[model samples]
Target chain A: MKFAVIVFPGSNCDIDMYHAIKDELGEEVEYVWHTETDLSQFDGVLIPGGFSYGDYLRCGAMANQSNIMAEVKKAAAAGKPVLGVCNGFQILTEAGLLPGALLRNRDLKFMCRTVQLKVENNNTLFTNHYEEGQVINIPIAHGEGNYYCDEETLAKLQANNQIVFTYSGDNPNGSLEDIAGIVNEQGNVLGMMPHPERAVDELVGGADGLELFKSIVKQWRENHVNN
Target chain B: MKKVKIYVTLRESILDPQGSAVKGSLTQIGYEEVQDLRIGKYLELTIGDTDRDIDTIVKEMCEKVLTNVVIEDYRFEIEEAN
Candidate 1:
């Protein structure tokens, strides 16, 4: 399956995501610039982490207005799968592809370390490979990873099973309900504050992240073949 | 020929840890009775010779670009430049 990784100015994790997809999963991956207006050539899009636009104004705020967001929105609306990691998650939320906003860490510090994430729901296309409530270690590095939503919206999200990941031990950024990751209502778009791409290989630390991409690619192929 | 003033703030429902921290310091300095405190962004824009719908544009900017509407609220006023 062909995967397109979106690259924006100040995006440092695109290469890491690319390598994780190609070198680890043996999947065909291509880099797409944030200025590109067309995404008709790929089956999936990955918005990797990093300080896009140097986190100016707000994290992912500037990157969301990039020329490519229009096409990304169309792709997402058409049921195309999109995965956003770290700053990418911020961009997605800013772009309105996902709900909730990432706020500054309560400690007002940039947190960088491996944290345990409990998979909240596995029915989505992104987490089918893992059982619900399973804990996995992934590195999270961000100064604004705190997720916030109103009580009503939080209840709706929980009832809909849109929440995908929650912190296992201590809540790192004071995120509501310890939400580390979530998916859109359609379950095709996911935005998580952690960097799974950074932990997809044992050499780097662990290979827990490899299967996420593999599962998506496998699902993409299955759907295409069925069609 | 009108001027607009915009005030953006985190919604009251959400916690303003930053603002709270500052208020705590105020209390530590022997100042009590500070009931409420919050932090927000303030923006001033000048539009004198443009026909564009500045309000619509500004609101769109706030929702899609400027303030993250999920956690923040924004309001603006247009007035004659003093």
Candidate 2:
């Protein structure tokens, strides 16, 4: 399986994502620029975390208009797997690849710490390895990490089982229903505020995040083998 | 020459930690009447043409970058300035 990490001007976590995939997963990973339009060679795309476009206008706001997002949207529409983390999540929401939106942290400050999140729905391709209600620890760092949506849309997300992750214990960012992450209707695209890539290695303090990547690669390999 | 105002706010289900923090500070300062506080974003855009559909543009901007619809809701209005 191959991984492609999109790099925007202010993206600081692309290398972290790249290393997590290449060094740990031992998978071939490529850093794709936000201006690159071609994605025919990659199997999956990872939009890493960071203050893209300096979080101007809003978090992930300006970065969503980057030239490469058009192709990213195309790939997402085609059912390609895409994982967006932190600022990437904001970008995905802005790009309409995912439902809902991220808002300012209710504290009006940049929250940086490990947060416990529950695997609200594990049936999706993104959370197949986690059991429903299982708690996972990941770091969330952002000033505008709150998530918002209308009641009708929220009901639809619940009905479709599109929500993938929810905060456990006390809600951290004031996200609706403590939503830490979510997938699109097709379940191929995922956007979350927590930094799973940062917790993939044990030396970094925890290895809980490694399972997500493993699950994806494992599913991809299994699907290919079965076909 | 039209004007539009957009109001964006976090849904009720979501907690307003910042608002709560402010409320706490207010209470510490002895302003206890403040029951609850909610924070929202407001945008006022000026459209040069009076008949143009500023609502659509405002909504698009909200979707594209103005607001994150996942956790927030936005409503807008267009009016002629007196």
- State the DockQ of every prediction: 0.74, 0.49
User: How would the docking of model 2 be graded?
Assistant: acceptable
Q: Pick the lDDT winner.
A: 1
Candidate 2 residue spans exceeding 4 A from truth: B1-82
Given candidate 2, what's the lDDT at residue B61?
Answer: 78
Off by over 4 Å in 1: B1-3, B52-57
What is each model's TM-score for chain A? 0.97, 0.97
Q: Kindly report the interface RMSD of candidate 2, rounded to 1 decimal.
A: 3.2
Query: For residues A39-82, could you state the per-residue lDDT of candidate 2 as single tens digits?
Result: 87888899999988888767877888888888888888877789
Task: Give the C-alpha miss distance for residue B43 in model 1, angstroms.
Answer: 1.6
Cα lDDT tens digits, model 2, B1-82, are 7787888887677777777888999999999999998778888887786464676777787886777656677898888865
